[model samples]
Target: MRNHGLVAFVITTAVLVPAAAHYLSAGHDQVVKFATATTSTLELAGAKIEARLEHPLVDPGESLRIKLVASSAVGKRLDVGLLVYGSKGDEDDRVPSPPVGVAHKTVSIAIDAEGNGSIEIAIPLAGAVENRYSPSPFTSYEVLVMAPRAATKLDRLRRNSALIGEGEGIPEYNASASKFMNLYSWRHDLQGEDATLFGEGVVARLDAHTRTINPAIAIETPSTTEVGKVFAVAVTVKNASRKPARGLVLDVETPIGVVDGAEGIEALVMPDNATFDLDAGESRRFQFRVMPDQVGVLGLYARVTCNGDDCDDDSALTKSGTFDATEIVKAQVVDEAPSIVGRK
Candidate 1:
C-alpha cells in the first residue's frame, strides 16, 4: 500500500499463501502481459479525484483506456497538467526508466465551475511489449500516469505547444519557450512543505505479465445471506489452452473481522500448497464453506495460478512462467437469509 498523497498502485500479482479475508476489486504478450482492472482514489489539494479502468484485463495491441474523474471545492474551472509514460522492464525489478515507444504524453484537464469533470485516454500498447529470448521471460510494460501540481503550468505548457497529443523522442522542452516536463524530478520537488500550496499529482501504474498459457478462474456464491449462517462458495478453474499445465493452485479468501484471529470466521478448506496438474482442456471445481459473523456485505476473492511452464528437462532451472487469474464475488449479509441461502 504505497501512497504519495493520493496515488494507489494495487499490484494484483497474487502471493501463493493462505490468505484470510483478503478482498479484491477486480492482461498480455508471448513473453505479452495482462493485468486485472482496478481503481485508485485520492485527494489532490482540495480536489477529490479517481482513476479507473473498465476492463479487467488488457494485452498487447489492445488499447489501455483509463477514466479520470475529479471534483474540487473551488468555484471556477481548474486547469491541470498530466504526463503519461510507458516502459518495459522485469516484473520483479524496480527502477523504471528510458520511456518506451513515443516518449510520453502531456495533457491538460479542466474542471468546470461545478468542480466536476472527467477525461479518458486510450493508448495502444503495441510499442510497450518487450520481446525476450529467455525460456521464461518475465517482463512488464509499466505505464505510469503523473499529474503534477494541477493548474500551475498547464497554461504555459499549452501556449508553448499542443501538449495533449503524443511526442517523439524524450525532448527537454515541449516548445521553444516551454520548460521540461520531467515527472521524475517533479515528484521529488513536491515532497517539500509547499507541496500542498501548489497542489499534488498522483501516480498510477499498470503492469503486464509474460506467459505461454494461462487459466480461466470463476467463482459462484449467493447474493444474500444471514449473519452466523453457513454458505458455500464454489470455485472453478479450467485450462483452456492447448498445452498441459502443472503447478496449478487455487485459493479462496473471506473477511477476517476486526477480531484478533480466524476463530469462527470461515473454515480452512483449501491448503496453501495444494498444487495439481491440469491437462489440455481440463477443469476442476472446489467448494468453500463460509459463515459470516457480523452483518454487512462480505467480499469473497479467489485466485488461480498456473506455472504454465517452459523449463529445462529435469525442470531444475525453472523458467518462472506465472499467470495468475483472480475473481471477486460479494455476498450480502442481512439479519435474515433469503430462500436461496437456506440450501446447503
Candidate 2:
C-alpha cells in the first residue's frame, strides 16, 4: 500500500488481494516517528488501553486474532473509539504496505472495569489461486488421492486425516507465505481529542507497531532425574500482555520420558494449571506434578493456550511466551526449549 506522503511498515508478507492496499488518510500530516517495536504501551483519555495479538498465525486465506482491552485508573470512566488495521509488509522488511483493505470490521469495547474484547482476522497475501503459496486452503493436504468407488468413504476419511502423512505442513506453509498480518490500531477519545505528545496539532494515533502483550513463562523441572522418581516443577506465567488474559491455560508438554504424576502420558490431567486467567501485569505460578518414568532428558516446555478444543488454526488464541519473540505469531513460532534460565 502506498501514498505519496504516507509512511508504511517494511514487513515480510504479501497481500493476496490487489485492492488490499489503499491510502491511510488519517490526517496525521506531520512526519512522526511511529514506534514499530511491538512491545510498548500507549495511554489515552484517562484510560490505559492496550492491543495484543495472540498469534499472527494463520492458514492461507485465514484470519489473525488481535486483543484490545481498556481500563481506567480509579475514578474516571471513559468511552473510546478504536480503529484496527491489518497489513502485510512490503517486499522490504522495514516498510509495510497498506492494510488488507477487505472491509475493516467495526467493534466497540467499553472501558470501565478492565473491559476486554478480541478479533480474529485474515491477513491478505499476494499469491495466485493455484499458486503454491495458497494451494488447497480447505484440504490442508498437499496430495489427495481418490480411491476406487467401493472404498470412497474410507479413503475420503483417511485422505483428510491430519495424521495421513503431513502432520501440519499445509497450514504452516500458508501462514508463512501470507504476511502474518501485522496489527496497527488507532484509538480515538470519544468525548474529546487530546494534545499530541509529539508537539504540534493533535491527531489520533495508531498503536506503535512495536507494542505487544505476551506471557513470560518460566518452567522449572529437574535437568536430570532417575526412573520412577516423583518430581515436581512449577510454571510461572506472567501476563505481559498489557491487558488481562482470560480463559488462559498453562499447557505443559512432557517429553517422551515423563508422564503426569496422576495420569499417564495420554491422560488429560485436570486441575493442574489447565485454567489460567490473568489481568495485565499479573503473574501466577502453578505446579506440574509429574513422574519421570524411563529416564532421559525430559525436555518439557510450557506453551499453547486455547479457549476451545482445537489448539492451532482454530484455537481462540496461541502465543509464544518469549522475550525476543518480537511478535506473537505462529509463522516462525518455535517454542522455547526448556532451560535453566536461572535457579527459579
Candidate 3:
C-alpha cells in the first residue's frame, strides 16, 4: 500500500495599508508622544491622537501600559473609551473582541495645562488561554482612543490627534513577526496535553502574499456510529470574502489515519478537481466515509487552502477534536464435523 501524504489546506490573508488620507479633521491639532523614544502621528476626525507605548511589545497575559495625552485649543471636558481590534491578515477587517482575541477598556482623563496631560491606561490580554493548544500566527492588533462627541471643534481636533497619534499612548499597531515568536507563550497552561510533550516552539511565519478575509473554518461529524461500520463525514466551507476564491482545496485529517478511497493520500493534493469558488457568505459541503479498522479512539481535523501553497502547518486555521470509539461485539469461528461421527 502506498503511504498517503496528509491532506492539509493553508489559507492566509494579506493586509495592505491603502494610500487614502488619514481619517482626521483638517483643522484639528494635537501632539502625542511614545514612551519608547520613537514618534509617530495619526489623524482621526481632523485631530491627531498622540500615543506612546511604555514598552515596545507585551507578552500575552501581561498588562500593556499606555500613556495618552490629548490637546485642543477648543478645550472642553469629554469622556473617552479605548478599544482594541485584531486581524489575521491585511484582507481581514478590524474585527471585534473574543473570537479575534481583541478587547476594550474605558478611562476618563482631563486635558490640563498646555492643552495636554497624560492618561495612563492598562489593557489586559484575554483569550491567552486558547493560544496554547492552538497557536495563531500572523496575529495583529490595533488600539484606538475614541473622541468625545460633545467637545467643541477645537477640542475634537485636539482629542482626535491625541488619541490617534503614533507616539507612546496612541494605538500602536504590531504583529508577531521576527521581533516576537509565539507571543502568547506566556499562557503555558493551554499549550498542549502536557507542556513537555509539545514544548514551546515559535509559530511558523505565514506567507505575506496571500490574503485572508474571514480567516476562519468549521467542521462537524455524526454524533453516533457503531463499531466496524462506515459513516459519512461532512465538511463545511465558508467564504468570508467579498470576492469569490478560485482553485480552493479543502483537506480533512482523521486520527484513525486516512480512510481508503479518500483523496489526497498519496500526495497532499486532493484527487478530484475538488476546486471551488465561493462568494461572500456562501457555504458548501463535502462528504467522505470513514470505516474504522478498530474501535478505541478517533478524531477529525479540517483545513481550507487557496492555491495549494497558502497555509500554516501548525496554526489552528486547521481544526481538530477527538471522539470515542468502542468495540461492542466479538467475532468467533464455529466447527462443523458432526456428520462424520453420526455415519460411524
Candidate 4:
C-alpha cells in the first residue's frame, strides 16, 4: 500500500512538472520588442509631409511615441504642418485633447537637400494629467507630416520620407510603420484576483479581481471547511495580456445570507491608474473570509474590470463572470459540558 501511494505521488508530480514548464516558457515569449521605422510623404493637412519617425514604441502607460524629422522633398522652400490624429480612417484630425502628462511643441523646419530638422517633440500619455481619461485596450493615433507645395512650382515641394534604420532606396517608405501598426492590433488574455476586508471584524477578506480579454473565472481552494465555521479565503489575480493593463477593478459576490458580520462587502479595490500598477507577467492576491451561517450549497461570483472607466457599467467597459464558491456542511453537534478538573 505504501509503495502504491508513493508511485502515484511521483506520477502526479512528473505529469505536472512538464505542464508547468510549458506554461512558463510560453509566457516568456510574450514580452514586447521595441523597434524603429521611417517614412516619406506622410499625407497630412490635404498635402504630403516629408519626414521620418524613429524609435517608436508602445509606452509603459499604453501610449505611442516616436522621434520625428521633417523637411521638403522638393528643393524649394515651403511651410510644414504636422498633426497627430487618433484614427486610421479618412477623418484624420488632431487628437481632441493631448493625452494627459504629455508635453508637445511644434517647430517649423527648412527643407534643404540634406533635410533640415528641429528638436524632437514629446507627447505625453493622455488622461493621466487630470485623472479624466480612462485606460483603453484598443487605441490608435496617426502622425501627419505635411508640407505645402510651392505656389509657383508645384513639383518643387516634395515630401519624401523613410523610416530611420532602412537604407536608401528601400522600395516602400512606410513599410516598417505599417508592420509596427499591425502589432498594435494583436490582443492578449489577462486574469487576476484580489481580496478586501469589510464588515465588523477584520477577519473578512475579499478576493482580487482578474482581468482578461476572455471572460472566465478560475478559483482554487487551499483547504477544506465544515458547516457554520468562519475561515479565511485567499484569491489570486493573473494578468494574461500580451501587453500590460492599467486601472483594474474586481468585484465578488457571495450568495449566502450574511452570518454575523459578512454583509455589504462585495467589491475589492485594486491599484487604479492612480495607484499601484500591475505589469504583464504579474499576479496579486486578496484575502477575505467565508462565514457559513447554515449548511447548504453556496455560490460565489467574481467580476473583473480592466483599462477603462465605469467598471460597473458594462455598456462602457468589459466584465468577467461569477466564480462559484465551494459548499460545505455544518458540524452536527456542539460540546457543551465541562470536564472534571484534574481528572485524566
The candidate 1 region of ten consecutive residues with least summed lDDT is 25-34
Model 3, residue 142: C-alpha shift (Å): 27
Provide the overall lDDT of each model, using Cα atoms, as 2-decimal numbers.
Answer: 0.44, 0.33, 0.37, 0.33
Q: In terms of TM-score, which candidate is strongest?
A: 1
Error of 2 at 179 (Å): 23
Model 1 bad stretches (over 4 Å): 1-77, 83-94, 97-182, 185-215, 254-275, 292-299, 305-344
lDDT of 3 by residue, 1-344 (tens): 22234333342321122324122111101001101222233333333446665442333445556566566522543345454434433222232112233444556656565555457777754332222233222123445454333112212222233212234443432331211222222245533432332123311111010011123553344444454454545555666655456556665444222222423211121232245656657777665444544333244444565664543343332332212112212234478767645555
TM per prediction: 0.40, 0.27, 0.30, 0.28
| Candidate 4 Cα lDDT to native | 0.33
> When superposed on Cα atoms, how far off is each prediction in RMSD?
13.3, 25.9, 21.6, 24.6
Ranking by TM-score: 1, 3, 4, 2
lDDT of 4 by residue, 1-344 (tens): 01111111111110111112211111111111212244444432322344544423233244344444444334434344334433222122221222111222344445567644443555533322211233222233444433322111111111122344334443332543443322222223212210111111111111111112222333333233565465444444566544455676544445332122322212111211112235666565544444544444344444456554422333222343333334445576778899768956
lDDT at 323 for candidate 1?
29
* lDDT, model 2, position 325: 12
Candidate 4 C-alpha error for residue 216, in Å: 6.3
lDDT per residue as tens, model 2, 1-344: 01113222232221122223232221111111111112123454444555554432223344334454555534434333333333333223232223322222333454344443323333332221221222111111011111122123222232233321233343221221221221111223222211232112112232212211133765444433344444445556776655566666665554221112312221112223467567778766665444443322333445546564423432223444211110011123469988867665
In candidate 3, how many Å is residue 41 off? 52
Off by over 4 Å in 4: 1-217, 222-224, 256-276, 307-318, 332-344
Q: Lowest-scoring 10 consecutive residues by lDDT in candidate 2? A: 137-146
